[model samples]
Target: MSYDEQGYGNRDSGGRGDDAYSTLGGTRQTRTRLPEGDPGAPHGRRPARNTRSLVMAAGVVVLLVAAIAFANLGGGDNNKATDSGAPGSSRSDTTGGTAPTAPTGTDPVTGKIGSIASGFAHDEQGAQSAAANYAVALGSVGMFEKSKRDVILNAVIAPSQIEHFRSTLDEAYSAPFFKNVGLNEDGTTPSGFTFVSRTTPIGTKVTSSSAEVTTVEVWCTGLIGLAGEGSTKPVSDGWFTITMELSWIDGGWKAVTHSQKDGPAPVSGDTRASSADEIAGAVNGFGGFTYAR
Candidate 1:
């Protein structure tokens, strides 16, 4: 995959055209309640990808980027979306897919390695679930930090590849990159504003599998940018599909490599962008979920 990890909305910006993403941009997710309110209902998972760190650096940036503008944004299959091929069309809602539900039953993770979810079930379904959740974790803002990033890497990455992945990511999270997202060179969120980035998996497909290795594609939508008054990078949504190559290791599946491509992005929505205050509030108040497939 030739890393095309950038762009959001169906509008032209920085020469990426309407359908393409600019350089790398991403954020964590904002979960809105579907009208039905069923826990089993699939909510949108943010667009996710694993970068050169045996994972993805761009996808990691995306986790802290988006904020939901509507309260009951529906998550549905992209194919089912009747997009008018216009910005702010109904497609954003439909791209999420019918299976893109909120978490249900037990939190899929049995525990956490620092903040990253861990202790996955050891089966095909379990592997898919772990990959789905890991996509969100790998795509999180926390991965920018050292200690937290280390724990997350250990939890989801194959041990043999960890050293290489970590080095790759460290180089990727450059000072210039941090500056673009309005963060200090150290990767800390600035005063008074919230940075958003999230990955919501619209659907998952296991392309091939064996007892030792598996290939999965997680089609996801993501939110990124900043929230709060005077924040220059206001929140916006984008979509992408991530393909992960996993190895069943220890008692779970771990990612050995991954890559990101732009979206099966449906049309952007017409919902008014939330005020920085409101967007910041939702980010601070709402806790992210442990995504399940």
Candidate 2:
């Protein structure tokens, strides 16, 4: 399911689970959790497109340009540094770099906890890698299941923040949220239906970094929903950026806190939306990447 179905909550609880995950706007911003429904529509149908949406789309284009410039300013150097001495470099100088639109042959961490990537290098690129992979894990189908969620949290969260993350997420993925997403209360998809929730990082930018801590922004696009005939929550696309504060702990980069915000999204093209079976088949056929630099 998409983060929207999860909804935002108190800080101690899981942050909001919407298109934009919980956001921290330089201060505490409290948001009430709302189910994924449009109240004015008949039977919670999505509202009709409005003029404001067009204006917003225009703004997103402008923002996308600025973001590209910013990414280019620092992305190249960082990528080269990442490309160079990843294995032995204790610190990488990311002062001037061009943000790569594709992978730069930077090797991902060699460690793994089940399918999760671990054992990241102690540098900026490592932090970015950790953030990207963690975003995938956080936005995956497993987060809906309690047992799977616990395993994921343990693998990605900093040791000190484990309990807080666990409790917060436990409360965040409530039964109501599950029902809203077309999943059973136990987080299982009904018979013959495929649930798809996947996050693919478009790129990563390091906002700040030190030997012990790094803050990275991962631009991501995702698909989430139930894929089957006659499904209310049909699979759809969303774009958001996840802000991760990662700390070097226990020989790996682990998340201390995370925040998300709506795009930087590009305008949608006129491409036809695929059928449910096509979408489901594609999701299953394409295995995800072990994201690196």
Candidate 3:
């Protein structure tokens, strides 16, 4: 059966419906097309309006646009701090003092543990950035291989939890699970097929923070499957949220715990699916980013 037909995207690595990361876990571009024409409206321009009328119309539009932006930006109490661990709730000290006027994407970190970014800043923004990158590392293609998985865990997980995460995930990504996802029992891609696994963080929110540790939630969407001609498990995208509790240890933020839930996903667009070769080529051609918030 096809990957989508089997509904594998909805399940965890263990093929269970539980928290994917609690089980030990762990893009997009929009192509805009202009409308061809208004079917009901006449093609010719209408008569010019008086300056007063045009000015009033413009003012009304400005107000409407501002209101919409405010609503979408969670202007009011929507992102306020709460004790309840909700999807969007976070500590209210948005940038130490006032909220940021724009999205907070700083320069990418320089230090690396292998290819993963490291040495994040020591602040609230830094905590969120660490969590975001950790989510990417944990959700990477490397996690499927034992050697690479250990490296990723060492880079991202806290020293105290490294062995625990290693052992737990080893059991989670069992040979059966590998075969289920169209990979070999040894967690290697079969000949002539590309196994795609990548995560892109959409946005991040700080749940709570302190001098010692911080909790952050990263909303992410990922692609996973075997990409090749006649493959049953063609590459597919799935949305999920990962919450990582990171501690300041060894002068860097490392994951204390990780958990995941299905999503705060948007409705899927009606874009046509790409062929297996096209998907594989795209995955190979494009490189991933080190996310920061």
CA deviation > 4 Å runs, candidate 1: 1-109
List ranges where model 3 is wrong by over 4 Å. 1-92, 95-107
Q: Highest lDDT among the candidates is held by which one? A: 2
Candidate 1 Cα lDDT to native: 0.54
| Candidate 2 C-alpha lDDT tens digits along 171-289 | 64566656656678777889878887777888888876665767677777776667888766666665666676677777888776665556666755435668878887887889877
Q: What do the candidate models score in CA lDDT, each in turn?
A: 0.54, 0.58, 0.57
Q: How do all models score by TM-score?
A: 0.65, 0.70, 0.68
RMSD (CA, Å), each prediction: 14.4, 11.6, 14.8
List, residue by residue over 1-293, the lDDT tens digit for candidate 3.
00000111222222223323111222111111123445467753333336424433432332232112111211111122334233443344455654442555677678989988888887767887787777777667777788987898888877776766566556556776676666788988899998876777787777676666676767778766678998766665656666666678889987765545556667554456687889989978988777754
Taking all chains together, the TM-score of candidate 1 against the true structure is 0.65
Best model per TM-score: 2
lDDT for 131 (candidate 2): 84
Candidate number with the higher TM-score (1 or 3): 3
